[model samples]
Target chain A: MQVCKKCLLNDNMPSVRINEDGLCNLCSTQYESRGIVNNNEEEISSLIKANREEKYQIILAYSGGKDSTYSLKMIKERYDASILAVTFDNGFLSDTCLKNIRTVTDNLDVDSIIIKYPAKKIIRAFKYIEDGKFFPRQSMERASAICNMCIMLIKNLIYYEAIIRRIPIICFGWTPGQVMTSKPLIKLNYTMVLKGFENIKNIITSRFGARYEKYFLDDAFMRENEANMPYLYYPFVKNNYKEDSVIEEIKEIGWIPPQNTDGNSSNCLLNSYANQCHVSKFGYHPYAFEISNLIREGYLTREEGLTKIGNVANPCSYKMICEQFEKITG
Target chain B: MNIQAVNEKLKEFFENNFLYGESFDDINGDESLIDKGYVDSIGIISLVAFIENAIGIKVYDSEIVPENFDSINSIYAYLKKKMNTQDKAV
Candidate 1:
């Protein structure tokens, strides 16, 4: 239960040690060695320029969240690159988020697609996480149940779209902490490591008696396109703009925060329940590491990060999540 | 490099970077580091980076299969083969 004085991470976090000065081992380690940097303007511009000649230059994993909305606006207006905005409708999107997605994409005049998965499949994935069978202990340090599976689906979809469209870049609205454990900008070859997820996939298949293979990029697809997989970019990770300023700017493009999401999410209604499930199992919100990363990077104050991870799930949201899962699973 | 040198270097890297300074007394040369809970997918990515930087070899996607990365022995063997191939090509 001991929290780091410097950030929101606690002793429960894997591989963490608090020092006499109250700084966690992660903070004390050679900061420069960490390679955590904000928006690399040169890299972003060069990537766009390098892919300028390609049709549909970028495939953005848009979620109608505030960060993603901002990213869509930037890719459209600032870079003026042709983009395909892809949203995976995980059957948990709030009404407000759907409207926001429509409004913002309409305003931006970008091509967009929504791929909705079966609610039963999503619930099955959740069942595995609820039972602590999906995510590795190290992964729990950064994200929760639904968030992890949702991200995997989104990334796979983006890779699928990018490969089919021959797009050279896949951009995300990921914050720094999300990319902290790995390089922010990675070659598509990194997908080779996804073989590791097969263990979790096997577990899900055994329990659900269903092959959710479509949710992941097949090895054949990766092998056929291995020579030309798109680069995965996290543009918002090191942006100089703070969250408040970005929210204010995106408002001009008709982006509005959802009423039903948890304190950490702007789009997914399932986040509140996922947070509750995560805390019940792990004794901490999965977002604690992400919020703490923001604090360490000076994007948020310590007090603000603490408040963001505080219990924000309401009874109505919890009841809705349970009812939806039961209806789908039954 | 010799296998002894490669083993020593990899043990040092894993202990320093991934193990949080914990020694590898329980780790076997042939056991799967990932299946044993010592590494995860993200850790594999970092290990790739470390190999590319520290060992000065690019790990192609085709080379990332489990046969090349499941354990200290596998990684050392992979690295030795890569270096030998590079030397011959040079």
Candidate 2:
């Protein structure tokens, strides 16, 4: 399939088109708007200082992924706030990922907490997914469909932990490319985000039984009070750094690639499967959404986006995913 | 018998639960919903749950589709019709 000349977008993607001059949806938006924007670093720095002046203990949603690692490092180096690095082991991380978590946490002098789901429940969840008999209707056409479920659970855990520890600022290392950083940090609206999860919970409850509801849902009162803070990606929205350079700079902070993983994944093996399934079903890798958004925002060019696509997912991973699915289902 | 009441209930449910963009105030009851940009396909399941929660109605898995949510008027009209049928069946 022909890729968009301007961004990582492919011609076959649903509802996306490249104009004759080769501008993708994202780049075209920027072109029409006259230019892109980069926020003032001094402003961001002053905001961080003002926010952290209370000596709040920062709860970092550490995924053991490179992005979160960079986030942890930034929060530690910049704010010098006491940081807690927490990872939710979804029962499928490669052995190397666990080792990297240890290495980075120790090097950064940050306290680490690792939470793992019960093996039986995770296996049952995996089997349910593999059976091809049950799937959440919302999962289609997205990369990380299964990972999304895991993330939802992890998010609830973080919120609960934040409340219990009285940690006011809950930080996750989401990059600008992942979710737009139009607004960096805002107080949580449990009602709005919670409502989105309700129907998805019904599907999960029906398939895996209602026993899992508490893990996937958060208390309303806590969400309304605690702050939701995200850092690394929004800065990129303003400065528009090359991913390679950011990855390189962070490597000096003792970041290392996990063994048996490719450039597309510096952290999770499950990501490869999710991306492959999304591409097979949707005719394009799911990363196209983020890449297209970045390109539209003038942070990256069409060629740059397409080049990065090769690094995010590999089709070959599908063979292993199919084998694993069959094994679980059997 | 509760069709109009059901419509009012669903409208209230949408406002209370659903978050729309800045243009939400411009939403008219009769316009095409997806065309008018109220919610995407992803919002449909949530809408189903909202109807179930508000109207105390049950919609089968097969009945979930664009036709049921094409417009606010359509959603209002459908809930009214379905709930009436349901009242009779009961």
Candidate 3:
């Protein structure tokens, strides 16, 4: 029950060390000056402006979520950059999220790719994810297993789309809360990515069979196009993350608050169920780790962090999620 | 901290937290965890964050390559180098 005074991360997480000063080890590290690189805004701008080859300068891994909607607006308004917005419809997106995707993309003149698989296959993949132990244990601190599965798949599909198209920048509207890294802009290391991809390949292919294997990059494709694959950019992580202002700003465009999700998410209807399952097994809210970063970065107060993670008791939306899922899987 | 103790802790952490129904008892220390499918790209991100948080070392973004982090032996060697550098600075 002990939460850090400096940030809202509780003692239940093994990585948290709430010291005598009442600051958690994560926050307390600030005094030691680790000198991590944060925000390559100028570099990102220069990179984007300099790259004139691709028709769409950045292929955004859009989730039709609040963050991506706002990022689309910013990238368009600021750089006047051409963008290809991509969404992986996991069959669990709230009705509001779907509508927001249409409204925002239509108004912004942003082209889109909605990657959707057969509903039965997608649901079966999710069922495997929900069975637990599908991903790294540390990722459980940040998101539920189901959410992690969705994110991993979405990222892969986006990467595949980007590489095939030879897009220069694979951008994600990841929140500062979500991506706590100091470096927002990252050059892709093909070797490291390939090495890391083995785990994902093993988990998904082993469970989903060869049907899902085509989602990954193949050696033949890499032999021809590996040199042209794009790097990734996270604009939200590097910029000031004022959620209140962003919500207001994005509201002017087309986004409306999703009705079916829990407080921590506005895109996925499965969020409440995922949060409950994650907390039931892990002894802490899944969003607590990610939300704690928001508090530390001044985007949210400790009370707000506590409130966000405190929603584990939200009426079980598992039935509601299943209703929508069954409608499709049938 | 003793090098063996640090290695043990690192291995213990990976096994307890990163395994997926596979037994780590037989995983060779020199084998690439990535190649063996014990760790993946995203898992390595978490591992790096854990190393930074638990070991209190500022891992340069460049140091996140497989050369320094792909195996238990490689990670221990990397950590020893980093700690030595810190100590010399002190």
Q: Best-fitting candidate, measured by lDDT?
A: 1
Candidate 1 chain A, poorest ten consecutive residues by summed lDDT: A30-39
Candidate 3 C-alpha error for residue B21, in Å: 20
Query: Tens-digit lDDT track for model 2 on A156-198?
Result: 7786776666665567776555554333333434543454455
How well does candidate 2 match the true structure, expressed as C-alpha RMSD?
11.7
Clashing pairs in 3: A196-B41
Interface RMSD of each: 5.4, 15.6, 5.7
User: What clash pairs does model 1 have?
Assistant: A38-A238, A39-A238, A39-A239
Clashing pairs in 2: A6-A302, A7-A302, A26-A296, A27-A296, A176-A233, A264-A311
Query: Cα miss at A137, model 2 (Å)?
Result: 10
lDDT of 2 at A123: 52
Give the residue spans of candidate 2 off by over 4 A: A18-22, A31-56, A123-142, A219-239, A298-301, A311-321, B1-90
Runs of candidate 1 with Cα error greater than 4 angstroms are A34-54, A181-184, A190-193, A209-211, B1-23, B45-90
Chain A TM-score of prediction number 2: 0.79
Q: Write the per-residue lDDT of candidate 1 for residues A155-178, one digit (tens) a residue.
A: 778888898888877888877656
TM-score versus the correct structure, for each prediction: 0.83, 0.67, 0.81
**Candidate number that wins on TM-score, 1 or 2:** 1
